[model samples]
Target: MAVGLLFLVCAGAVLYSAEAQDPYSELPDYYKRGVDLALEQLNSHAGVHHHFRFLRSLDKSDIESGFGVRYLYHHFYLKPTRCAKGTTESNPQTCPFRNDRPLMDCAVCYKAAEDQIEPSPKPYVHCIQKPRLTQDMRTARTDHCKKMTYNSGAPTLLAVSTG
Candidate 1:
């Protein structure tokens, strides 16, 4: 009885650890799809040179926009990879992260619905570059991005946006 109990405990612990390591695994299929589409959009932006990989999700929200439509919002962090933009030789998964470039904090908002005849709504992509790696600098940048309003102007090192 004791041996069986020990085995069950070990199995449970292992499963819990696996879940903790990949928070994305718990997200719904639609959410995962949204993240992939958002990442692709982020990479295609002219301001982005090197490829970036998803680091972690900062925030997310799902809102019912009346009828069958729903709005999805995802805010996440991205780290630059060694691969250059539009590089056919390497992908984000295989490319190692580059320490030289600044980190990106991005937010994507889009609409989702079933049996929709109209074209999908254009996604809103906004990314803020965090050049400094210091803890205080990161906090300040995060705070600044949270407060700043979205802009549709030309891209800069400090901000990149697409609609």
Candidate 2:
């Protein structure tokens, strides 16, 4: 009986210690009060709502930068929208649109190699989605690969890493 009791105590202590490591687990008194006040105004009727696509795109950019989305957003876009929407790779002329490069650099040339893209795309946020290229433009994947590999080190592309 004593052995079982001791074991229980030890297990409880281990659990408590593990949880104690997080300073914000319960938040400080000031934070708790702030949270209470904030929640006071929040009810079932009121909510912060946004589409998953929008949030996901935002998160993807954030994760890619590994820093505050705001910081990356500011440095890259020169405002705060480029990370998710678009930023130019080289000259703002060739592949001059948002989210142009794959990864940091969208599969730009890769885009050309695959097929002609889309039609007239209206601008959204900071950048506009590009219209599909004509058939003659995407004659060969190799051509695109060449261009994609080329990086002009534009201000946006070469700026400081926010992360």
Candidate 3:
């Protein structure tokens, strides 16, 4: 009986270690699919080289229960800006915005409009001047360090959503 119990414990340990080593290996099929889909969308929208690290299963009951599918609160680092990289400290006083205008809703807009793209919202009046580079926007500490993790290379969670 003791030998049998010991074998079971060892087996469980082995399985746990294996799962830890390859985070995606033990994910349920639906969960894996969701992560893959999200990653693809992020890559295409953000940039091919943008990095992402999975934090954890936000909620699997939806997929397990055969409800459509949703991954709520799975944390990820947005692609860092060039200014972020150039800054020396996590809490730097300021950083430069990208010189060229960056795409915002453009990708989704283009996908929806396709060849029927319309000119900029008629008359194209600027609503407000862009903030100066010296603007002291206070980034959350977690966000500032998300891509700057220690040797492990995974960002600590900045914010998580319950919904």
**Which candidate tops TM-score?**
1
The CA lDDT of each predicted structure is 0.61, 0.25, 0.32
- Compute the lDDT of residue 25 as modeled in candidate 2: 32
Candidate 2 per-residue C-alpha lDDT over 63-133 given as tens digits, one digit per residue, 9 for 90 to 100: 12222111112111111124222233443222212343222111111111112221212101122112443
For the record, the alpha-carbon RMSD of candidate 1 to the native fold, in angstroms, is 9.0
Least accurate stretch of 10 residues (summed lDDT) in model 1? 154-163
**lDDT tens string, model 1, 43-144?**
778887887776777777665545676555667777888888788363346567788877786665556675222234555565668553456655554454
lDDT of 2 at 39: 23
- Which whole-number lDDT from 0 to 100 does residue 94 have in model 2? 29
**Using alpha carbons, what is the TM-score of model 1?**
0.54
| Cα deviation of 15, candidate 1, in Å | 11
lDDT of 3 by residue, 60-158 (tens): 222111133222112221222334322335532223324344221100111002222223321111111123212232233223323322224322323
TM-score list, all predictions:
0.54, 0.20, 0.29
Candidate 2 — which residues are off by over 4 angstroms? Answer: 1-5, 13-25, 44-163
